[model samples]
Target: MKKKIFLVSTAAALFLVACGINSGISSEQIGLRKASLENENKVVLADINYSAAQPGEASVYDRSYENAPPLIPHSTEDLLPITKDNNSCLSCHDKAIATDVGATPIPPTHYYDFRHNKSMGDVISDTRFNCTQCHVPQSDAKPIVGNTFKADFTNKDLLKKSNLIDVINEGVK
Candidate 1:
């Protein structure tokens, strides 16, 4: 009887310790809660899902046109993507060279003049330098779930990418 009591006590203590360990851990640490995902009290799913993709799970942009956004179609050579330090979108489009490529130069509207600091007076700066901050990949990615889409413009040549409002409405449906 004493042995059984000792064994039972040990099991109960182990169980309590396990529970205590988790209780002491912050919700973020345990992933049950995240301040990062809290957008006005709603848990944002985009920031939470990071999968260790399977081997070869991500193609080398090898998807077909029906399954992909139009691939860059040409080499963005010497281009400085907005993530210049890490981006590749502007290496070819920066006004310095777009004329050579017969492509329009990046617009004046695209630049942010950060002349606030006296030292930076009259200098246009790349604010929010991360290209993804304002421009998203033209991923033409398929919907994760089934989507029945009909083009608003019946002409094949006129089918363009959806704007923000269009994408949001698609999500709602």
Candidate 2:
């Protein structure tokens, strides 16, 4: 029994040593970037060019996936820093005024509170006030990693619009 254990241990050690000697990977080859992990100076990001078109002039892009936050089609240069006191986005995107200005209205989900599960009645829920948390302006920068994902919308209307409120509890027990 002792001889069998000794031979098994010896074979396992030899196999591990052989693997280390034959297939050792360097630090540079460990990551997808194929660059030295210690060097930040060597890493260069692709140039990001956001939309320069003003609101109502830029074209809306199809949703990346079902219930995905729609990207800001126009430049947000002058409408940033959404504070509690001032949210420039509401000037155009508020439900009451959005249609008049040809801007997409803040969805019904924004008016309903998920935590308390009640309607706020004409007020944007505090949780949904920060539009940029989920939504971002579109950029022309190339992706660092390749993706082959294609969004499969159940219906054509879901391609551009979100029905998160309608389907939020679809599978929940």
Candidate 3:
């Protein structure tokens, strides 16, 4: 009897793993909601302090295309990515649906034609398969570790005052 019970439990575990339809992050990581810790992390719903109260325009996770990547606001482990024929972003971004979900939908950028792609002969997955590759959520929460980033913008005047421009004008004097 114990052997049968273990077999059934193992099968169920395999099935869930095969299905990517789960929150990609843990509750403790995102800081809200409830979940079980058995093979997954958990959080108490009461622990939630803030929420996406009202849905607005579809969010663009990566604010600066040249800088950091965006993070997901909600769970996306369960979401299916876009492929050659399917773009699932429209599923939630249509104002009719996104407003109800309390999260923004995909922005018009998704509609833009990205020249980036893989050659069919190369057998690569469509470049869009990994949404996280480009877009990322900006979290207000504290950093997971000490930040190393220092401001280069703040030092702009340092160069302007150095008379360094005149030196360069001499061309290696």
Candidate that scores best on TM-score: 2
lDDT of 2 by residue, 3-54 (tens): 9999999999999999977897766787777777888677666677999999
Residue 80's lDDT within candidate 2 is 95
lDDT values of the candidates? 0.44, 0.91, 0.46
TM-score of 2: 0.79
Rank by TM-score (best first): 2, 1, 3
Model 2 score (lDDT):
0.91
In order of lDDT, best first, we have: 2, 3, 1
TM-score versus the correct structure, for each prediction: 0.30, 0.79, 0.30
Q: Which number leads on lDDT?
A: 2
Residue-level lDDT tens digits of model 1 in 16-98: 99998878765454454454332436565453332233322332232222222322333333433444455455644465766
In candidate 2 the C-alpha lDDT for residue 108 amounts to: 93
> How far does residue 147 in candidate 2 sit from its true spot (Å)?
1.3
> What does each candidate score in C-alpha RMSD?
14.8, 3.3, 17.0
Cα lDDT, model 2, residue 43: 67
